[model samples]
Target: MTRGTVILKNGKVFIALGYSNSDSYPSGEIGQMLVKALSNSSDEETVQIIRELIGGLQKDEFSKDCMESLREIGEAFYNKKAATKVGLDDVYGYYYDYSYVYDIKTRKLQIFHFGQLEYSFKKEDFPFLRLVVENDELLYTLSYDTKNKCFKGIDAEVKKVKRMKKAGKSPQYILEIAKSLSERIHYVVDEVYSSDCWPNAVQKGVTFYPSRKRLKFIFKENYGKWNVYIQLPWVRQGLIHNCTSRKAAMNKLIAYLDGNWESFQSGMDLYELYEDCQQKLMNFYNACDQISITKDEFNESVGQIEKEFRGKLIPLEELDYSGWTKAFGPDRAKKEIANWIFMTHRHIFDCIQKA
Candidate 1:
């Protein structure tokens, strides 16, 4: 059982429902306050209580009314694209957006949306809150108790989380929740793009697609600027590649592959790749340093490697099924990840080169 709590940062509040034992965390203070506020609110009037609480916050800590404020934060984060020089989104990190409860007897996963955000496709300042007008539902209530009684509510997200543990499920991983929610929100955002394309219709300045060459890249169009990310196919928590204006997130990822790059390029088949392709990459890495390579240079260099490797290499689409580093231990996962990057990255490049 995982629970959610709203954390206040720099006067802005982010939801952190998945955190357990809040006593040791810095966000515990706000998390405690939020739990207190939610537990004390009128059981029959959750939405109203949230609104009243939000309306009662001070200026410096404006996010007290988190549900309403998230819309504002999202707008502020995304609206930068309209400017000639877009700034970084203020709310960049993962937030606890949803809580899951499991029944020991039934083994069912009940998902609860954390704040007023819709958690679905909707057009408005904040995607989640737009659902308020469409339905008379309360925020932060567990799925089981949501339909139970209007007055019944849990004081802490940990209440359900405890039961989940006994039932043999540990609700951990802050990034896991953040990544899952972010992906869902992105889906909603995508629908808006294909159809509504918020703040304005027919928005065409930004686009995203995979690479079509021998390497994997996420071609990104921000406003009118273009960049690419070296894709780490094994990563599940969202964009593993970080990006700056001049370079993609590949620099860091390339560093992870350094040992293998060295070994393979040194005429040693570290992971049994097709000999021909390894020889080509050996030549490339032996002759060049990736740290100084630019995107166009990378594109130009792909041809020879692609010609040699291409489909001759087998791809490890997924490494584990148990997940949460279950297939292998952490060290083993790390090794496999490095090998996977060397073997599979170019395949993504082959798929999206022209797009």
Candidate 2:
């Protein structure tokens, strides 16, 4: 049996790519076509052909092993300087094991974002996917490792439940899935403490925060992976830090309770405060560009400000420029409402001043 070479981007598995013959393949023609497909990352068409060759064989021992590697090597055509050689370098060629690619991606991803957990389909019909969850995070790629043969990273452990179906384009649905998964992992240790988990009053004594500020763990999705962090009322911004695993997340939550966590910023109700500030800022900004300032100006200015900041004392009644009463002067209207709003915000609470 004569041969041709199918060089792969990865060279971890340097074994012989079987010679062409009539039994498994018609000739070396099939081999060259595979190389082309892999080079282009031709998803559907190439994947379909490779499927027939692999059939039901274990990945490492398949007849179409080298060609199957197109799943990974095909990511970007095989360039010697930037590729890994898979299978043996006979005339028949090399292929990707996807498992090797998964490992390589895992190592490379750690260099950039340790929280990234990337995964993808290695073959068109292959039920198992590749997964890569980077360090200290209950990280695994069902799409990197065999979520069944799941890997343990620095601070996290991973397992694959059934693939999420509702994790579609819906933000609310995805958030729900993330919350469920995160809390399920949390309940394993700290009564649903981490994993995008919400802080609950545990018997009024066990609290995630020393203050009444609600500390919610956030698994903010970054691309396909998640940027796992916390959302605390005291935090001025999100993405406080990466929580690599379920256990690590709980440990950090403990830090907050123990009054030891060093956050980027600290103040109560920061997100809501930011929302209020943004609304007011935009209202002021829009007013500045207006050519004329009359009823429209009042509508935009007084209307928006009142809408956003409703006073605890009294509602912002509509302006009555036409029927101005002598006793209820304009100065008091501005003082009791607008000035009060400003003063209430300006007055620094002791907790904030101390913090």
Q: By TM-score, who's the top model here?
A: 2
Candidate 1, residues 1-355, lDDT tens digits: the string is: 3334322222233321123322322123322333333344343343333334333433333333433544455423212232213343333333344422222223122223332222221111121222222221122212222111221233243233323233333224322332332222100001111322222212111111111112232435455443433322243222232345323333333333332322212212212344344456556654444245554676567555554343433232232223121322334433554475457546544433533
Off by over 4 Å in 2: 1-44, 47-125, 130-157, 160-180, 185-253, 257-270, 273-277, 294-300, 311-355
After superposition, candidate 1 runs with Cα above 4 Å error: 1-31, 37-42, 45-49, 59-245, 252-355
lDDT of 2 by residue, 137-201 (tens): 22221113211111224112222232322222232343343344443321111233233333321
lDDT of 2: 0.32
Each candidate: what lDDT? 0.31, 0.32
